[model samples]
Target: MTARSGWVKIVGLGPGADSLVTLEAQAVLAEATDVVGYIPYVARVADRPGLTKHASDNRVEIARSQHALSMAAEGKRVAVVSSGDPGVFAMASAVFEALEAGPDAWKDLHIEVIPGITASLAAAARAGAPLGHDFCTINLSDNLKPWSLIEKRLRLAVEADFAMAFYNPRSKSRPEGFARVLDLLRETCEPDRLMIFARAVSAPDETLSVVPLSDATPEMADMRTMVIVGSSLTRRIAGTSHVYTPRFVAE
Candidate 1:
């Protein structure tokens, strides 16, 4: 494709920190003629001459993806922004889904994914490596998937002894689901299993707390929080808030 031809770059803004934004994502933003994403994510991009920002509400991923693709097809350099890594529960998949179902010529457009740090990794770093060992990441929200699947995965992850990171743990519409998750963990794991609630990680108002599974409450987590449930081996330092899981599991 020629330089004047349209292209789409799915960009990750990282977890609430400008410094965490990857150089490649930044370069794409600088060159992009249009930015598209959720309201907050699109707002994260600084305004510049000749750049237009399109923001949409939640649950509109497909529509948003289609809009970006349409603009790209019209020869606009579009950047679709996501808060964390674009591939991790974000816009990259949505954009591809749109492209697949759209006109076949859309597939010929230049598209690239620019990666960035995800909430799980950022939260793990702030909490001293709780994800050091084998772990699985799951989105607790039932918006797109059934709650049964979420519960099933949680049970299996517990049985397999893998540390788990949960995204979209709780929200206003589904406040009760996280409590159910807590109960499920209580049934399947030890009371003292460490649970880390890393809220608004890397931002000015960031708060990180490590508590035992018995003491964890759903209220500690909100839409902005990243909840990490430790494996049996996960532990906190004797007198500090730091938590970690040993890299090697004993035979």
Candidate 2:
């Protein structure tokens, strides 16, 4: 008989609603011998008789991923949960980072990445599908990359007239970066360009507002907020929150 070996399953818990968690993800969560993730994400999983939850602080993604990898290597079914889709600016990449740096034997381990509703998509739906045509997503956090690089990408995305969604747009420590981003947007786009700030989507405090670029303020967004800068063709339905980009490409 083949020896029982451990495995890792990366999962996204969705935004904030329990119903948002997929049935497949829930099954993996139920069968998990060890649940590992950041404190808030781990808290979402209910206490169960056979499951052990391991919660750690934010910003220590590599170490946390290694912990989950180690647990799974010991024959435990481990689920590393992230708030949104793991592959989208979350723990999935961190796990792969750890795996690549670990021994070749680790490569033989079974690993599965289960997708879930990401914040950007949820926020986009709350608004009117500004991403209706072509779009790109950016992670504005300078933690992993430099600010100059982010600005360059932002400028290029605008130059190409792509509808854009941003993750980690701002935090308490990096407040000024987002302000600079706004300045960049104002440089290449008109004052009336549509911008949407969707905060805490699906949660009780959820607030989504569509405004013109001139009216956008730095304080309007935070780490929990998803910012979408509309293309030249994006517009709103006069008096409603509805905003969308036309399907036809513009010259």
Candidate 3:
């Protein structure tokens, strides 16, 4: 399966599990002459003939995107792999950013972005649909934004009483920022608000924990975790701790 030369495919590999990857992404990988992505994601691709893998460290998205574009310019079929949906905190935007900011020649390259199963959706599926109702997705990493702005959004979300899915809850250098989020939730939400800590969803090392905001701790989450906070209408079933927000509100 040979992809046509001189194109770039920004593709998602899903959260984990080869079966979770979309057939379209798989087709592109089969035809790719070069694959570029973060180390873990590139590793997901099977080793095969005629496929050159280029893995890089995290936080170098722009550099990685530019490298893929350069390869495409040289008439290489390049696929940039991203875990989960490429458009959701992944490589799609980075590739486009590089194309827009790079030399004018890049605009002529054929670029396609393929989506995949994102972490939040996977986590919610595992946790019995805590996000079944109105919700918002927030990337808690302040790497690209200010902490003050994040805090403002946090308060506003709580004020609106919307269920929330948070990505990149805790990074090595920014562990304290998540702690601050917990504090804000404590101050703004009820003590019994349900919070779900879902880590590495669909992977072998996956873990899911549901607890009240009173018992929820920062240590439960890490960079790979997605935190889902239930809204005011969220509740635990009578016989168990399974939490969910109702699809319809009662008067």
The candidate maximizing lDDT is: 1
Q: Which parts of model 2 have CA positions greater than 4 angstroms off? A: 1-3
Candidate 2 residue-wise lDDT, 25-87, digit = tens: 999999898999999999999998989999999999999988888777778899999988999
- In terms of lDDT, model 1 sits at 0.94
- What does each candidate score in C-alpha RMSD? 1.4, 1.4, 1.9
Worst 10 residues of 1 by lDDT: 1-10
Give per-model TM-scores: 0.97, 0.97, 0.96
lDDT of each: 0.94, 0.92, 0.91
Worst 10 residues of 3 by lDDT: 1-10
Model 1 agreement with the true structure over 44-100: per-residue lDDT tens digits: 899989999999998899999999888888899999999989999999999999999
Per-residue lDDT of 83-119 in model 3, one digit per residue for the tens?
Answer: 9999998899989988999998889889999899999
Question: Model 3, residue 220: displacement in angstroms?
Answer: 0.8
Give the clash count for each candidate.
Answer: 0, 1, 0
Indicate whether candidate 2 or candidate 3 has the larger lDDT.
Answer: 2
